[model samples]
Structure formats: C-alpha cells, structure tokens
Target: MQPQFQSMQTTGSIAVGQNRVLRNTYLMLAVSMVPTLIGALVGIQMRFSFFAGSPLVSFLVFMGVAWGFMWGIEKNKNSGLGVALLLGFTFFMGLMLSRVLQVALGFSNGGSIIAMAAGGTAATFFVLSSIAATTKRDFSGMSSFLTVGAIVLLLAIVANIFLQIPGLYLAISAGIALLSAAWMLYDIQNIVRGGETNYVSASLSVYLNLYNLFVSLINLLMALTGQRE
Candidate 1:
C-alpha cells in the first residue's frame, strides 16, 4: 500500500492545485459511494458472493480482481477510465461486503449495530480529517507506523483463516479499525498539505481506508451488541 501511494506522480509546490484536487477527490469519493451502496443493497437481496467454504480461495480471487482494477485505474488516471474503474471497484467491494452484511442483519439488534458503526465511522473521519487540515505538524511520520500496523493486521487476518480463533478475530478487527483511522488521517493530511496531488489516486486511498474502517466497526459492533434470536 505504501509503495502504491508513493508510485503516484507528484506535482511540485502547488498548494492551491492540491487543495482543488483534494476537494474534487472528496466529491468524487462521495459520488463514487452511490454505486457502492446500490451494489451492497442488491447483493443483500441476491446473496451474491464469489466464494464460500474457502477463505483462501475467496481472498485470492478478491485480491486478483481488485488489484487488477487498481492497476488499470492507476494507468489511466489522466482519463475518464480511472473514474469508471474506481466506481466499478467500489461496486465489487460492496458486493463482497454482502456476506458480512447478511450475517450482521441476522442479529436481533443488527440494524442498530449497523447504524452505530456508520455513525462511529463518520465521526472518526470528521475528527481526524479536521485535525489533519488544521494542524501544521506533519502526520507524514504516521505513514510508516500505520503501514506497519496495517501489515500486522493483514497478517493476523490471514493467519486466522487457519486458526479460526474468535479472540484473534476480535483483536484483528480492533487493530484494523485503529489502523484505518490512522490511515484516513494520514491520507487526508497529505491532501491538505499537497503531498498528494492526484485526485483519482487520493480518492482511491481514502475510500479503501473508509471501507476498512466501516467494516471493522460493523464487525465489532455486531459482536458486542448483536442479540441473536
């Protein structure tokens, strides 16, 4: 992920341009969400999934498709193709989320848990983003820490596919939520300070962070507040 971020071309000394890019990126991010929600809603009704009973298979499939789309987007960010690919990727992610959404909606308090998680995610984003824009202190330093944290969280999640431990899942979820929050801050701060100039790439990075945070929070809330009937 860190390498992917660094791979973007940087324009020098244009805070105004960066700000415009950031603003447009956010607008695109907001607009990009529509397809995602639609996809998730349809997925819930259709119960669509790429795999079952094989986490490894599912993981590999998802990675392959997602990375392929990401590569294409990066290659074509200067064209309309990037926006199309980004939205397409979001829809794919939304479809992927249905499995968790299905399990979550099964709990008696599922809807409440989902709402709370959404609220929490929104609040976290607002607060972190505000600090990122206002503070003169650099959060670029957090990149390394957040990257390391994310790698560990990813490894733990992969390990759990075999271990199948509840405790491990909880820990990974918590770590991911934290890392996602950190990532959001880092990405947003970079945007504000002009470290990130490509609106398409910026939107993609922040969108992924938001998606991870939302999923992690939803999982945590379901475990803690869900009431099985």
Candidate 2:
C-alpha cells in the first residue's frame, strides 16, 4: 500500500511539472508574436529583400541564417538567452514574410485576402490545439511522417523557385499549409504529454508551425482568389 501511494505521488508531481511547462510554453508563444508584428511593420516600411538579383542565392542565404539562429536557440534553450534568440529569429521571419505580404498587398482586395488568411490560420490553430489538449489520442506516430513531408515540401519549393512553375508552386503551398497544421497538432500533444520539457524549445516549435501555416495560407489565398490591381 505504501509503494502504491508513493508511485501515485510521483505521478502527481510529474503531472504538475508538465502542466507548468505547457503553460509557460503558451505564454512565451503569445509574447513572441509582438516582435513578429513589429518586425513585419518595419519590414514593410523598408521594403527589404534578401536579394535583388538571384532567387537561388537568396534562398540559400536565408536558410543558412535561419539554421544558425535555430542552432543558437537550441544551445541556449535552458537559459534566458534562448528567449532572446527566439524572438530575434521570429523578427527575421517576419521580415522574410514581408516579401509575400507586399505581393499580396498589390492585389485590389489585398486587405480582405490577408484578413481571411489570418482568420483561417487562427481557426486551424484553435481547433488543432483544442483537440490535442482535450483528446486522449497520441500523436507521436505523426512525427516521422510529418518530418518526411516537410522535407519533400522544402525540396518542392526550392525546385519551383528554379522551375518557375505556377502550378507546382500552388501545390507546394497547399502541402505546406497541411503539414504545418499537422505539426502544430503534434507539437501541442507533445507538450501535453510531457514529451517536450523545455518551454523555449516548445515555443520555437509551435511558433514555426504557426508561421509556416500563415505563410502557406496566404500563398494559397493569393493564388486562388487574389484580385489583381
């Protein structure tokens, strides 16, 4: 009876710890959005572009810089520096997003299209997150499949840049949006199940998922319904 009681206590403690981590993760995720918005506003004003001449070069440079930031964030995940680096990364992402946002804004109904994309992304996140939190389903099995899908999506995107194929670009955007939604579900479940313990890392994972989802959704909307000015 004593052993069983002790086991119960241990489990209870673990549950509390996981709950704390998950709560902090959510808080950090919310806070990170501020920097993203600020960066986007500034980027729009500056009209920043990573490259003016070479699309392939711009893509490669952006990937290198992004991976470097991710590595630094991972190395510092347990410290305050991780939070700083994560916010910085999001800022960079927002600046990157300006390119798409600028193009979207060129449409006659650009504002409406952007708002619709944002609303759709929020709805997707809320639904997936609620399901992960309330249901007993384990999404661990999705990790490998999502990873493979992401890799394929990345390759398709890079190829499309060079091929300049409109059809493939739209298809890749749709694929990315679906994969991002799946990733968000998987990530939230991981946090709920205590599979991920670090809030910094968790925030980064979830933020990337949402960022990708938003970007992809905007691309799809532009392709499907954007009205040319």
lDDT of 2 by residue, 104-157 (tens): 999998899889989998999889989999998788999899989999998997
lDDT per model, in order? 0.87, 0.91
* Candidate 2 stretches greater than 4 Å from native: none
* lDDT digits (tens) for residues 170-226 of candidate 1: 889998898898899899998988788889999999999989999999999887888
Residue 170, candidate 2: C-alpha displacement in angstroms: 0.4
List candidate 1 segments past 4 Å from native. 1-13
Cα lDDT, model 1, residue 49: 64
